[model samples]
Target: MPAHIGRPVIRLAAHRVTTDALLDHIAATCRDADDPTKPHPRLGLWKRLIRNTGVEQRYWTRPLQEATAPSSVGHRAGVAFGDALDLAESAARDALDVAGLDPGDVDAIVTSHTTSWTVPGMDVHLIERLGLRPTVTRIGLSTLACVGGAQSLVHALWHTLARPGARVLVVVAETLSTIYHESETTPQSMMYRALFGDSAGAAVVTGLTDETSADLPTGFVALDPLELVMPNSRDRYWGTIDDEGLHFDSTRKAAAAATDAVPYITDWLGKRRPEWAIVHPGGPRIIDDVVTSIGLAEKAGRYSHASLAENGNLGGTAVLDVLARTHDDPPAPGSPGALIAFGPGFTAAGVYGAWI
Candidate 1:
């Protein structure tokens, strides 16, 4: 059975931060008061790198002034988990409402959140808070990073295909602000501060119904999902832990991770150009590389670029935000398109589909 995805909904954190504000905050917090001669050696480099991220603004779970303050990992985890849950609930409710579905209608739930570590994760919390059936199946993803949104939809599609008329709720939430601890001073760590945002995205996926039951608003009918992890790329992007909190780290080679996956993606796409494309807003290079390699027009990546500019990366929620924008300015009905996202494993996840 084909899986039909409804329009996605995204909920951003309370604090809206602009690039200028972010740079200023970094400067104020990372100064060397005692050793004025040093003056934080990396400040100039960090500023230059941040400006190149193509992120004009972003949102955070906490205020800029407090987020950069020194705090323990335990305290960061508690606040991060709480904030992620709040955003996820809002996004899920709005998604269900958009699909004209009640919580009871969901047969399964798929959730992805990597910014915090929680024993009973967002999936279980949502099952109770959203009033979903106790017997509803659940899948939780904790470390897929930017790939979580597309990967969640892929899992939901599998569930719908397995249980033909079943409805699956897909949610991805990230409170990346929790990782903005002042102790992280590396170039890679600083880049993340400028590139990531806190947001939650949700969508409903179900098996395609007969004409009589076609009242559902299917934004797209999903094709089989594709996944790939590049060889020897484990060090390209990964997570780290310390007294402060969780931090995202990457090597210089991370810049080419997206380009490296292009051939595989192109092959999986049957070496043909899709009518529309929903590339992840990992950054400008990731978006531009994929669009150009796949022979898509520069305008085809507008949604991805806009998402990066308006909300930073949104981590796992990046692709969902791009998908929402696609729905807003839809392509010709029945046009073919592709949705793709990249993550920490230097992995790529994608789904080909046609507008409905």
Candidate 2:
């Protein structure tokens, strides 16, 4: 039986920072404030990279001024994880409510979080907070980054396929703002600092049943899922930790990483042209390259662009936010569509499905 996905629910951090505000914050915090007349030696490059990220505004877990303040790793971890959990729980509750399911009705949970590391992680906390069964099956992904949403959905599909009638809760949350510290000054780090935001998203996937089939929400019916890793591409993007906090590092090759994966994805998709596309809003170039390469209409990428402009890159939560927007402007019933996301490890995850 094919698993059915519910419309996703997205929750963002409380603080909204516009591009101008973020630039101001960075100049004040990262550059030498002693002399207002002199910009940091690298300020020009940072501005160029940040301007190209395609983010107009983004939400942060804390005030923009305080987000990049110097702090111990342990303190950062606590704040980021706590805030992310708050968003995650809210998103999860709303997701289940929309699907007409109680917490106890969830047979399994799939979560992806990479912002802050903690023992027992988000799964254990969510099980307690959401009152899910103690014995519920769970998969916690810690390093998938931007691909988390699509990859978690793939796991949900697998669970439902193996355990018919089971319902799997998919949650992806990230406090990427926690990693935006003054210590990270590399070009790639600066770009990431500007590109990321904080958000949590959740969706429900269930195998069709005689009882549940009639109640299934109008959304995607999961078909084939693809997981791909480009050979010799591990260094394109990666994570590192220092005394200050976690940092994302990337080489120049990272810019073309998504474009390089197009052939593999198109092969997996065969000749089917998707009527709709849920492209991860990683950056404008990534979205443009994928949509054009895969033969999707220019409008197919609007949801992704809109998400990026409104919320920045939500890391692991981005794909779900885009999916949520797709739900708002739904396609024709039973039309074929595709969902794809890219992340560190030069990894790509995708699902070919149809509107229901």
Candidate 3:
């Protein structure tokens, strides 16, 4: 179970859109479709949610108007897949550089993405783009949502543990803006529009051959007793695709589910309290709930909050963004830290680690 994860590299979409622009677009789109004189009843609610998201701006593959414009499902899927590949390729290359390795040095490539569907997936494309060895093992994971980034690290850790001296490249990328539909004006749709952003993150995990190689950048040696919890509460959040577009269903109960699962997580942690709590920024509410439930210090989740306030939620790649920031400003050496992320499974994935 000895492995070291390198510093994560993040690639954001080219266009940065503000929450105010998004609200204006939504209002204009709704007004054009309905009565122009009277304001939509839910408009105020949508504005409040967007303002309260704690996200001042978010990056997207395209401008706000183009990204949220009415479009055929097929067209949107094609565009999103292309954008995902572009971002993933950039992030993977930078990660390999950070690890002081070339594409050929990677023994395996693990990827997590849920915004687009394609036959060989983004993994194969990365293998080709990065010039990874033909024999490199590839694993593609989908539908894990925000938890996918942390889960990818778990997968990489196992790969290194099972294959000695192995070096695995893990990538988590999402183009959530492409899934936005102008036709769906529900609160969930508005929330998704306001909160979701496009970004990609990558990391390199190398098996610890011996104690000497423990001088890894970022103090990312794997911690023992990694844990993944799934409460079988999938109904709390999900997405469906239809002729119109992708629709997301996320209930207020999602936050409650996370809060309710805290005791079980604490029991698993037992007596060890991490000095740094790296919780996913699902939103402002989820962060507050997790911090309060787990009794983390007031500023323990600053990295997660910073990611949310700066980038919104990058879906599966959100946690990794925070991780990258944490590595840049790591905790004191020998201090313990925990990584936590929640997603569509209504599941929480956590791993405890120590700074080098």
Clash pairs (backbone) in predicted model 1: none
Per residue, candidate 2 scores C-alpha lDDT tens digits across 1-356 of: 78899999999999998988888877776655587677777888888889999999999989976887889988998899999999999999999999999999999999999989978979999999999999999898888989999999999998988998899999999999987877767888788888999999999998887876886678999988999999999989899887787888888899999999999999999988888899999999999999988987777899999999999999989999998999998999999999999999999999998998
RMSD after CA superposition, every candidate: 1.5, 1.4, 1.7
lDDT of 3 by residue, 1-356 (tens): 67777788999999999887888887877763366776677888889877888898999999887887888788888888899999999999999888889888899999999887788888899999999999999888887878888888888888887898899999989999976887777777778778888999999988888753755666567775344556677778888998856767878776577776787778877898877777889888788777766767668888889999899999889988988898889889888777788878677777677777
Taking all chains together, each candidate's TM-score versus the true structure is 0.97, 0.97, 0.95
lDDT string, candidate 1, 70-135, tens digits: 888999999999999999999999999998889998999999999999999899999989999999
Count of clashing pairs, candidate 2: 0
lDDT of 2 at 70: 89
In angstroms, the error of model 3 at 309 is 0.9
1 or 3, greater by TM-score: 1
- Greater TM-score among 2 and 3 belongs to 2
**Candidate lDDT (C-alpha), each:** 0.90, 0.91, 0.83
Worst 10 residues of 1 by lDDT: 209-218
10 residues in a row with least lDDT, candidate 2: 29-38
